[model samples]
Target: MAVSTRTSSIGGHQREPSGTLRLSVPTSYGHKRVLPLLPAFRARYPRVEIDVHVSNRSVDFAAEGFDVAIRILPPSDSSLVVRKLEDAAFVVVAAPGYLRRAGTPQTIADLQQHECIQFLRPASGRPLPWYLHEDGREQEIVTAGSYCVSDDVTGCITLLRHGAGLLQTLRFMVEDELRDGTLVKVMSHCAGSARPVSLLYPHRRALPLRVRVFIDFIVEKSTAWRRAKL
Candidate 1:
């Protein structure tokens, strides 16, 4: 769809897109990537005020009065209109400093011989499962850690940086580490497939102009991440 050049007016007055936008996002993704692009959105829509809640808890759009929400987790609520965004692949990683000290695992089964930081879902009190390519088949492997973070997949990166343990997380989250040699991919051969990313908003007859532009802005800027890096 093409955007119209026609000026928008309200009540006989030309108005710039303006309104308050309340939203929620996963903590680490919001802070590292999504939140950084916001200044550009602010420049485009000067009058739009944005309020964001960075949390692991699932949001109730109507019950909480939120306008939009971005989640890495699968959608559990069917009421909101969900627009899937970029998909991401996961990688098992460790810091170079840590690897030098503890040594690398030679095989997927060898991971048990090393320390591994794990992530858990606060909602279910269960650790997120790892799917590794093994013997020409994707197999599930349960990983454990001395420390765990609920809903914050990014924290695993921080821990891995400290030589806490090997952890599997989004490839994008550790790109800088991989590029600078601060962190090394542990098992590229057994890395997993892409996982869904999505944005959710109330299902309504029409979205407010302010909210609509934001949705467009985010989705438009997200094209690069949509490409397969694995």
Candidate 2:
């Protein structure tokens, strides 16, 4: 059976197609994790238009009129529905040349002596803390480095590849380079500390068709993404 419905715009003065859904995700999403699911999403919903905004900063979903957001951090408002997607692992990586020059740091404490490349949040102008695990305990190390770059993971990867310094980055970001032996993981003891990835949507009595469809699609795709590794 086929059914049709219509919804008035928030302003209540105009009506538009409700089948369109807008999504906001980190720009890095396309390059690493979310890119693989695009073709499948399009094939499943040919009529649903997906508008993707690639950004590093937090998105105001209600104010900005985005239907859903895939984010790394949890939302502040209790009114939003947050779903845990996965625990993403991060590692300390350095280019082969960099390792050769400084020598690989076999222990977390050894990081104190090497140059580090830091990723900064442009909105806050603060460098992200490097997280590591040691002896069954997790530690957030405040690193001192001469080089700091704004949310440019690609540039950091480039710097690391050229033997610039050590970079704390998600494993997925450097998987290929590690596989090819261009980059090597440093501080094996601190390798597994990771953050949780999440999907968030505004709380509502009922979700519109478009938002509902996309959320379901994301859940299905992400599940498959995890299962494939097994």
Candidate 3:
């Protein structure tokens, strides 16, 4: 879609008209990876205004009138167009104090002996599963801990930082702390599964100008961001 670059004046003030874009994104560690792009997006398209709705539950983009939604897991519905943005690796992390106090787990089996901070989705009462990969094989392990909280990224990180049990979180969430030694990787050899970050939009014959522009921008910037991280 071609967007008009013509500048217009509103209320006697010369300003570009802002195009509103609605997005529904999952509230998870993955959001920490994608949310940083908003400033750059706004800088590039100053006329675009974005409204982000954060939720762990799947949203009906078409039904809810959302322009697009970014999700770690793509929707199963065939009517939506899904674009894979990047592959993210998950890791098991614990605060330095927690590891010093509880001792670090040397293997996947050792994890059973440590207290694990579990994430329970508020929308659904089920606890998130920790999928670990070791020796070219994958295993889904259900972890148990004394502390259980709703799926909030900040809360989980805070709990982990306060010497809570092992947390199975996306690498993107703790990259800074991991580099600075605040949080330590528990199982280096057992790098967990990699999940794809995807962009989902309605499969319309002609996408709105604002939606098309933002989608293209995200695809371009996401590719560059992923490449730079490598």
TM-score of each: 0.88, 0.82, 0.86
Q: Evaluate all candidate structures by whole-model CA lDDT and list the values in order.
A: 0.80, 0.76, 0.79
How far does residue 227 in candidate 1 sit from its true spot (Å)? 3.9
Each prediction's Cα RMSD? 2.5, 5.3, 4.0
**How many backbone clashes are present in model 1?**
0
Model 2 stretches with alpha carbons more than 4 Å out: 1-18, 134-136, 228-230
Tens-place lDDT per residue, model 1, 128-211, is: 778888889888898766887777777777888989988878777887778888888988888877678888898898678888
**Clash statistics: count for each candidate:** 0, 0, 0
Tens digit of lDDT per residue, candidate 3, span 23-130? 888776336755777887788778789888887768777568899988886578898889988877888899989888889898888978999888886767778788
TM-score of 3: 0.86
- lDDT, model 3, position 35: 74
> Which stretches of candidate 3 lie above 4 Å from their native place?
1-18, 29-31, 228-230
Residue 19 lDDT in candidate 2? 66
